[model samples]
Target: MKKQLATALAALVMAPAMSATSVDLGYKAYTSDTKSDNGGAYDQPFVKLTHFNKADWGTLLAYVKLENPGEVKDAQHGKDGKLTVKSLLIVDKQIGDTSYNFWGQNFLVSNRTVMEDNLYLGVTTNRKYGALFINAGVGLNYSAAHFDPTGASFDGISGYAAVINARYPFSAMGLKHSLSVNYEGQIDRDEDHMSTLGYDSYGHQIITTLKTSMTESFYTKLHMTHFDSWGAAPNDGIEYGVAVGFTF
Candidate 1:
């Protein structure tokens, strides 16, 4: 299953390369309080790479993060921390549009540190209210996890997942700025499986970001994330960070 998933991810990464894609490369220094019994707090720098492609069929957005670039050896992530990859492909072909703007499928994949992987499939919709752009989706979720510290593992259908992303772009102080709010929730999870892995029956993550462009290609972002019954144990907390990056 892992190999198959990896292959699929490779295909996704390569698909954009065959077409016209916009890419961004940068470095980010973020502090995260999310941790497990073996993994402690992370206060290191990481490199981020993002890709976006829009075509007649749909749109694809993907990002890869190299976390803890050069950190001391740790029990959880080993010498160099870990790598996390996430991608979402939205098929936006109108399906008998009825003002609600019912788009097509939404495929989401999230893989982290080779310990946890999730796949989701469902429908998505997009709406705009003046300057605000909203995209939402609801889907079935399948997750596989292996926590080495406690020797606990889960590999099966986890539950239902939903996501909402909203962004408002405006100009202020002679600079282009945007405010975005993203929410993701996993509900109706298998309690037995989640409990063994130190997770609640439901998990939620919310992130709010304010981004300002210093120039056409350079920007800065301030981010605050709230975690509830998510990540490892003792997961309820707020993590904040600032990031500066360049876009190409």
Candidate 2:
């Protein structure tokens, strides 16, 4: 599955007029309060790949979190992390100051993990005001669960959510920078499971990101995310990560 996804993304990026296509590869480290049984923390490293405007189609993005290559396993399904793939399509329709977007994303957690797969379909619109850009959208989400070998099995669940985002551009430390905030709320159902399977009761999430342009084709970002939920596994913790990317 991972190979297939990589191949498809490469094909799209290498299509005609490929020089116009841009790709960024970055490294990210995430720290969370969640811990494993052996008192080891759930901090992990990830490799992120992003492709923009391939064949005038859309942007393709993917990331994979990895466990230490030679780390010892504490359980059958060790603390291996997650993989996520996102495809964003621009509608190319500009009404006054707003532009439209349609997007889809797939989330795949480690094998035997609680959250098996999450699929999303959404439409969004954005507008700019001075140095600020705002976005709003609605989306449908479907989440599947992993079967616990020694616990109760779970089935797939589906729901819908609303999203809003705000971004401000500024200059700091003699570098071009931007600050963005995003919020997603589950209005139709309070148990959408956008983040996790067993943690399905999460109704909302908030994310804040600070990014700086290091060069014409390079940049860096620092981000923090929080999940709100009241489920069996309450994922009400904060996750933070730092990343650096370069475009070609």
Candidate 3:
């Protein structure tokens, strides 16, 4: 009974994670860009959907999210690996970018205005232990990005984010605790940067995570990510969730 309860509690904390078949929504409080002119509401809704088939169940698949704010209210639909259609590209792009795409793999991608009209491509592969995954890619925006230009703020950038993670089963609580470091950079385009073409960046970086599990189905998930640019001071924010969830 205690084990079952523990699992249930863990699931509760992990609810926001395993929603591959249901619609989910949430809102936030302290975002720098939260529009006060739009409405009296302080909460910007966190709404999304998840749908997957057996083919995509076990692997860790991340999104190269995009966003186009005024162009769409936010809607994404897909039946399988093929997307029905979505404007998340607009959203992903609008959220802001400070990293270069990878040259090999892509786990979670969001480059709004790196090149313009053109979306980047990426590839990723994991180590045998699943403890390490290396990703690389190149991004050429279809349009040049001038962030906050005209006060309209068209955020655009291209960079790569690499995450190395390790997890071990916590026997005491029947849980798995994971720790990771996600690093990103822009492709330097100069003779001096040629030595580091695959490296260098305008840094805006931070530590992030999902932890504190007392139940197999419930845990407290915490998220915070930040990156830096030449003129832009690094920005960061935190997201918290307590809900029930599971891997299988």
For candidate 3, write residues 7-36 as lDDT tens digits: 987654454333333233333333444222
- State how far residue 72 of model 1 sits from its true place (Å): 5.3
lDDT of 2 by residue, 95-165 (tens): 34436667565655544334355566787776789989887877786655554554444445466766788
RMSD of each: 7.3, 7.7, 15.0
TM-score of each: 0.74, 0.63, 0.40
Report the C-alpha lDDT of model 1 over 75-177, residue by residue, as the tens digit.
3455445444444444544345432333433333222432666677667777899999998888887777766657677778888888898999999999999
lDDT of 1: 0.64
Give the candidates in order of lDDT, highest first.
1, 2, 3
Candidate 1 versus truth, CA RMSD in Å, comes to 7.3
The alpha-carbon lDDT assigned to residue 18 of candidate 3 equals: 33
List of clashing residue pairs for candidate 2: none
- The list of candidate 3 runs beyond 4 A from truth reads 1-118, 130-172, 189-201, 212-219, 230-248
lDDT of each: 0.64, 0.55, 0.32
Better of 1 and 3 by TM-score: 1
lDDT of 3: 0.32
TM-score of 3: 0.40
